[model samples]
Target: MLLMGVERFPTTADPHGEPAPGHTDWPRLPFVPGLMSRLDLAYKRVGYEVLSVAEPDRRAVMLHSDAAVHSSTTRIVHALSHGTPAADLSRSPAAAGQEHVHMVPACATLGTGTDVSQWVRIAHQQAQPTLFVIDLCRAGRSARLSELTRVPDGELNAWVIAATSPDRPAYDGRFSEAVAEVLEQIADHGLDTSPSIRFVRWDRVTRAIQNSLEGLGSSQRIHTTRVDVSQELPELPFFPNPRWRPGTRLEKLHDVVPPVRAFVADLGAEHFMDRVDDHFVGRQSQLHWLAAWLDDDRVGGLRVVTGAPGSGKSALLGALVCSGHEAVIDAAPDIRAYLSAQSPEGVCSPNPLLAAIHSRGRDIDAVMTSIALQWRLPSEPERRWSVADLISEAGTLPAVPALVFDALDEAEDPDDLMKSLLIPLAGAVRPDGRSLVRLLVGTRRWPAGPLLTLAGRDGGLLDLDDVPVEEIRSDLRSHMLRRLSSLPQYIPPEQRPIRTALAETVAEALTEETDRMHEWGPFLVARIFGHVLATQPVPDNVDAAVARGRTVPRSLPDVLELDLDRRPDGKDLRAVLAAVAFAKGDGFPTEAVAAVAPEFAPTPNVAAGCSLARATDQDLLQHVRGLLDAGSFYLRTGVETDGSTLYRLFHQGLADYLQAHPYPLDSATRSEAI
Candidate 1:
């Protein structure tokens, strides 16, 4: 085991003008922030003290300690021999306007009183075309015992670099282990004499590895598994002000004045008719504002629409997509007039457009399949990028080609799927120049990390409140009417009164000057419908069902509380809630769930239901009703491969709610309480 150490180069800030000798402010360095933590851990593991040597002299920034002076001196000689200047190396600034600073490679050192034979073995190991790890915590640098193998401490010093930044921290143990393994392999293979290890610059390591992989073939090239070092930073909380201040965003809910009403309606919930008429009933003026923004030819770029869950962000995105799509298609004639003339108005008849959309992933794959069905592309010799293939296989005219990624945060594997895959695909432009692509995404504010990054990088953010309440309300009304008419139970007597009462409630609630009504759309549409439906007089069990249902609870908030309260024994109900709320694929099966909560498995007959089948059936019904109007949990149920019915949650919000308001854990506590 070769030893390694780090000399913390403390930079002295300038008392006058120039920085004091060895002075450095580390965070500003973009790469340094990400690199510092790793190197620090590596040096610490190798058992040595890291010292800052930032002197102007060529030998500045040397690993200094009482032990292993020969190794340290040898490292300096190696640097001098390499003709590498002894100036402090600086990294690019991470944040704008931050000062740049210098950072040296991590310098390793040896400890006192090591076994001579062991030192020689490790030293000879280092002399090979191998990575010498100085585990400062456990051991020091070992001197080579043999005349044939001379390990320069300077060579080891030149190998390591200071960790990135303290702010952008990283973990160690495994990372060290990985590095150690690679080093050990290099020594065992006698790679030093054969290929002659080329210690490339630390920064060029990745490129060197890649080239080597290609040259040596995959089997021979060691794929350096870079640890996910980004995890060290403390996770920033979602909200700055954790206290849920009542009525902050609520005022927009009502704003009966034309401007207010239009903005409220944009939230996509016409079900809250009372609020609509009272605060935002007939505000048509805001549509003109949106129309003007949409019609602007100069604003031809990606745009983002964002808001809280009930804020009508999705509705606005749909409306925008519909508006610009035609214009975009119409503009394509300028790129290729002949192609446009050959294709029908709705047909995707452009090769470039087809290629752009077919770049990657299942979502796009489904979109392509639908296109293939519509275009009636021939099943003969399958065409790749031919014009006929484009016409026949392509679905609709991808005019304006607005790739609207609705509810990005809702997507499974958001980081890898959205950030890495979908987003990059959407940003690509067709080389043929027939159509323009724009990406618009909508998501709730809670998990807005990637979305926020997208906005900052490529688009502008649009708050839902920016849209007029009246327009939103009008759209809501139309949507509600359509939905109500579609539902079999909501016809005639039920529709008329429910519609009337809903309208009145919305108007009254929204018109009140004291009430902030803009944010009420999602809640009113979803929650109110859920409550009313649960309370409805069903033909099967009007009295008995009503009695049981009434006991179950009526409101959205109350219903959630009831479900949580219904847990028989408080065996980590919070865990149960979390497990159910964030099930991997919508929901988990009873058996799968039992794995998450094994204690409940033995008493499945009583705790869940009679049998697994009965429990699953009942759970499905509960899930359906439970998800109907709630903002958080959405129910998904189906039988699994194990012949057991499974259920899952649709949103992360339910898990968040559970974590925030958790119940007591375990059988002992429940028994004691009983």
Candidate 2:
């Protein structure tokens, strides 16, 4: 097969005219050069035939740069082919420009911004590249700040991504920091890894970058478009003759992390999980109320415990989960509980709870499993587990099961969740007229929101405001002392007496100041401790610093910013913090942060005097100790009870702060590594 390739460039200095020594468009073709590098390695790894088109002495207008010497045809075949999709690889140009294509300046400035038709025309001209990926974007006006995080379209299959919406200024090469990051990620790990026929899943790389860009705030959204291929391309692991096998029915649960995390992230803890330094105080009445719901003959009604953070509503719910309310223990000892630990606020469809997998990460597979397995009923996957199916599964069980959802107001769409999950479950009845399941919901009391009517309807209301100011003070004091214990270890043993005395003074001062604020949630108190630990040694004038309220935040968002300010890893820590903050309920994996900036994972922890790149899990944990505690701004979503965890902004305050102030990510900060 004779293959002839032509690229028109103003400069051709390095013999083959590759990333021409001084060519203007050199950097824009990063992937072009990158793939060439992979092709050379592909040859070494798979031993593909390397044919030289050049007749050495004859020169023969041949491609000769280190990476450019090899054939792209072979690289695309092994590194980019998806099954037997038919198309050849080639390039052409049309629609030289469009309105404000700010994504990749290096490419757009040259003559890139083109419509799908132009690309299709070009594809037809080239005989069609087997896997043609046209990286393009047309910036669009981002609406009011209120609708910032909303993606314009939900169904995306095209290859185009909006790196920068129209409102942003045009960049030099159309190459977003996001594109560079993913391309490098793909290169680091070979594009195609088929045991049999080697075919690259090009769509996965684009999709990964698209998803990552959303974390950059609403200004950058992504979409995909078809170029010219007509084959019904198969989904993901894009290899020819894809291999697979089925295992035991239960074995299929391995891939349910995102959904379960979403489910739990939206679900409230049974009550509250207290950090060693944090304590859950008061709300005994609320706990009893939750227990009564489980055992009461009248089933399926909302048992709401409402309060601001730190008010113990969540703790009351948590306690019930751990040790069912005492009222029910004597009457209904066999009752079981299913919990939703995170908020389900922003979801458009309640179907996330109905299916095992949801693209948006709102699946409830884990909860169903618990309910099914606990009752010894057939709990098929979420897709097949309808409301009727649940009732059928529970029909034979002697003990009635209870469902508790916490943090209703925090849900992306509390009103939607209430209508979809709460009311439906509440209304689900048996032949005896009693609802099939007991229900408990905990949320904030909104002054004027959709949940008021639902919150008021016949169910019991446990308000934290009635819990007395003195009880909160006692809880705050207890919390302060526990935080102080962690600080003595940070101080040198020789100076213990002075430091301990000073730290206690500071903690006492903080508690008093905290009691004055609104319910001083566990999170704010934790930061106060973080501040004390950070600026330790009980300065020569400790009494003065304590009295001055040196580090306490005026508001919750301020607390997050302050905590971020105290992070030990400098820029690296700041960048990762921003990502976790934006991740919200859908927490990220350890490697996810690494994808944004290769240097982040490898960056040195100058404060701890070690490189994070080589740090052990314990080292990583130690480095992020500030974020691990209860009420801390970030939470790590890990496999069941395992010390290992991936991070997300657990505190709503952090998410609110980031939405208001997308720092370390605004145009200026983005110029850096993140």
Candidate 3:
């Protein structure tokens, strides 16, 4: 991760100090800000420590050392390991800078007017054989990479990997970024996925780097050479090779507890097609800002993210929470987990704080006991499990935990949540005297009055709808293609094999519709896949289909009406859906729903216009299940503590729709309300 910044910097000086002539500040220059840190992050992402390194203002600073060290390291050799400990030595900065010391045909390209012999001498001084990846300009005037530096006989041979042979400029993190990706790719695939070679040998890294360029969308080619009998690098992994076990990395894996794993896995990224073609595409700036904010020593509190339906709010939050992803976003160092009321898998609870705590593998019963003991809830033992009680308990947590509350507006008790869980959690204090929690909540803007009180001045609001639409268009396009490509592998080859041409057509149409209509979201794309797939003779007119699809009303009343049209007994389906949609807490008990649903006296010839002799609750339920499976409606079904299946819709939009357009129920419902 060490970056030897080659750029010039401005070092402020008193005009009378007579800095390098009119050059106030020595034309002072240092490494790129965050560049070295990013490279370190790259290796750390793969569970390696490249050691002490970089950003201009970061931990490692390469001050204006003498140029003499470039060609001759005898006097000023201490520059290499100044800030960094002896155990950690950098490989990139020096490598990239080495090119500047080489000879060109007539004149050197940006050289210090010295040969690379000094650098060669320094390479042999490393504690272990080092892998030196030099960034050499491939411009027509440059010499061959191998010719630039020659090692003296009897010295230890170091591995040299060169980003050369083709013309290219070394910009911010160019070679470093590509190198990071290459190592990560190799690590992910494991040595078995690669061609047979010694896993820890230089040959493996060389081949993998070259092969990785294609996947990285890079034209840069890297060449490698081994000077002699170099030792192996234990960092290279081989899944099948039992003999080559990863050290320290295994301990790191165990440190990530099961509860932590569950919390992250539940995030959308670890599941579905998200792991493959994740399209959190346009929110890098937001993510980076969030990462910096989260990791900032000066700030710690709630970060609220809101968006209209289909704005990809959940996906963005999920990316930040999932494992391996935290590094990409530079999240807080100690993120226990991220919990959302509206998990992509539809797993939720009425008491989200409780759910989140339990998701982290914390003992909810114990947490409740501790809170009850400390704060004294009502005399009744059962009342201690309430949202406020749990929130109080969260404040006494062992660590500065992070909790992500997604879709608060979708909570069964938004007001109760605001008063008990959210407000308290927002201002909670940890047992150790630190803040109670680091929270990121995603929800729609609603019941604005209460939310505003919680927001205060420190709160942040990121409205997905407020973001530039072009960015969302790109994300949706990528998501659509990824989803399209996943079908064949996910669906058994024996059934409904997708033709490449058909997939391309559908993807193009879906992307265009989502982008053109500005309606691309996870839900919309999923529904498109379902509806379009059902159509026979996959239509060639993608745009026309997309146009027709958008015409499917988004408004609740219109949507309910459209869903009703899908079945023959539209009235029965609609009534059942209305009951389920309006049920409280994901959905009240089935018996409760039946009590409120419209009922009719038994008719002798009920089979006359309808298929069923009489519409039993089971019949209506079967129809409801079809609607749920069709994506026309969004509902979650979970078992209650009493063992009955509770069905409710997590979508606040649908609930709003159901409220405005209540079914024409003939049942005695005024007294049967939940």
Candidate 4:
């Protein structure tokens, strides 16, 4: 880690000893020294080697003057852009290795000694996973440096966090102080008690800093760039949780099984949904019904939320978990009084046990083990716990425990999961004729077994298909507007108005198309058309953009098929998607994708007018990277062990589509791909 603090800058002279124009001698922020000290101690406590180049450290290169600061900044950029040699490492604290963090707390202005352009230029040639925490005025503008340099997003490997937006000024010392406070809090008190999450992610850290700044009465908003690509920076041991023990009873559950990280990172889950929490609108009636059901002491069986493909079932469940039951009621004042009257104590458990079946699918054993661990059931080495054991354990707790499971149809054996775990847990009853546990499940279709019988008897099913057409349309439009505004391409304040108008126009067109065609729903329309509109150039007239939006296909599969047929590299893209869909375990690594894509490539022939050349390994890799950078609707990304990229289909729906309409390949080519 490299820490640089500049509280003051020279006004009269530049680094070259020339007369500096439009440069002001920034006032010294006394709190900077203390902030750096706190950070140094906090990082050391969390087992990071502390390297400081800030104030009052005479042994290291000091930022005492403009020339020194400028020279140091240039050297740091050189080390990051090029390879760091022994000389560079010895002269400066910045290291050119993977997972290095560079933090600067200074007054940055254009044409000043502390200008950040040189630091931002490092993104042009960054080859490792690097993080930059810029605490200065207009720090967020550093992200635009890539645009100015014409560097593509996939080529850049740097993650940035700025104290304020591009057109705003930051309150001196507040951002740095917030960072120190958050790091200290994580080091002293762990971020979460769940053993499934072993580290405090960078996204969580940014939220904590924002909350701290808000408490200090600062209106400045922090901006982050390339967040999705490097959101797992903390998993690089950026900040290890002090409370995570390796051999605890809960930890043993994940010993042979894969970690639930993929489910946690799902687009509909808490981590990703939290980014768009404000955009979540509508679903009040559904939420109200769920709230009433959760609070009712008379009910304890399963409450399945069923919907067709592209329906917003996942989003609704995700919102419920992100915002607790009370927040839901508080958002709807009319329903709050009635809900409070029904349950005076409260509507639901404060923190429910939440889990989603992995997209690749989890077995019955893994499913039961996860539930048992979350309930804090004691692990017995000699005996394996069953569904009955979990039910009995829940009855002993002071309050009833709620178990929320999503994507039940995505399980390895849906029938086994329904029969072995969910069915029994739903029917478990206490001695007083009350339900032992509260169960909620989300699935694309109803299971064909005893689970259906339970739902029929209890009347606990909430079918999203039954939602009014107008309500669904309104909710989807709201979702599209929110999604458009949050795209990284249009995040700057200057681009907001144009994107807003375009979002409104596009949302209207897509919602109208959905009305004409009954199959399309919220998930498909928002994802498909949102990506389509975001990638297109902004029109000079909002009215003109509406015409362009009307040109989109009427159905999800048609849009996907159109994309496959139109692109120049369509065949190669399909090959990569197939590889990801058929991949075992988590997903396919970039190296594996590159190796397998060529086998599925088209054969050269003159009769069919096949003019495209065979792609090399480098070409294949670059193609995949470009797709990810362009925000392909079909692909999702993960990090490999060496910090490279991994690729997977965005959801099971896409995989299903690909399976139904597979690309043809010759027998020899198909065998090689297999």
User: Could you tell me every candidate's TM-score relative to the true structure?
Assistant: 0.33, 0.45, 0.42, 0.53
Model 1 Cα shift for residue 617 (angstroms): 14
Best by TM-score: 4
Can you tell me which runs of candidate 3 are displaced by over 4 Å? 1-299, 310-398, 411-413, 419-421, 428-434, 448-456, 486-536, 541-564, 567-571, 588-613, 617-633, 662-674
TM-score of model 2 (CA atoms): 0.45
Q: Candidate 3 at 629: error in angstroms?
A: 6.3
* Best by the lDDT measure: 4
Q: Candidates' lDDT values, in order? A: 0.34, 0.40, 0.42, 0.55
Q: How many backbone overlaps does candidate 1 show?
A: 72
Q: Which of the two, 1 or 4, has more lDDT?
A: 4
Estimate, for each residue in 76-125, the C-alpha lDDT of model 4 and write its tens digit.
Answer: 11101111111222333234222222222232222222334444554334
How do the residues 1-674 of candidate 2 rate in per-residue lDDT, one tens digit apiece?
11111112223355455553223332233333343343444333433344322111112221121122132343221111001000111221123222222122212122222122222222222322322222333332211112222322222111233333433432332334454444444443332222121333445555655754554333445433332243334333222212122222111222234433233332222112323333333344444455555545445555566665545555455445433322222222222222122121111111111122112323343344544543457644444455557666655445445665566666555566566555666566665666666666666776214344555677456666555555654545445444554455534554444444544553445445544454545435444455545454444544554543345544454455455555554444554555565553455544454443223343454665435445454344334433233223355343221111355664554555555544444345533411
Q: What residue runs in model 1 are displaced by over 4 Å at the alpha carbon?
A: 1-300, 312-401, 410-436, 446-460, 470-490, 493-498, 506-528, 537-579, 585-587, 594-633, 637-646, 650-655, 658-674
Alpha-carbon deviation at 59 in model 2, angstroms: 44
Is candidate 2 or 3 superior in TM-score? 2
- Per-residue lDDT of candidate 3, residues 1-674 (tens digit): 22343334335566666554322132222333344555555555545544432212221221222222222222211111111101111233344543333311111121232223334344446434333455434321122335433653234434455554434433333455566565554454332221222243445456656665555567666654533335333332211221233443322322332322222332332232223332234455566655555544333477777655555566556555542233211222222223221122221212112222112113344333433433333346445476555655655544344555555565445565556566766776665666666667676666434554465466476766666655654544444445444554424443233333344333344345544333334344434343344433433344544544344343234434554555455555455556666665335654555555453212325553442225464454343444344433344444333223456653445566566555533334422321
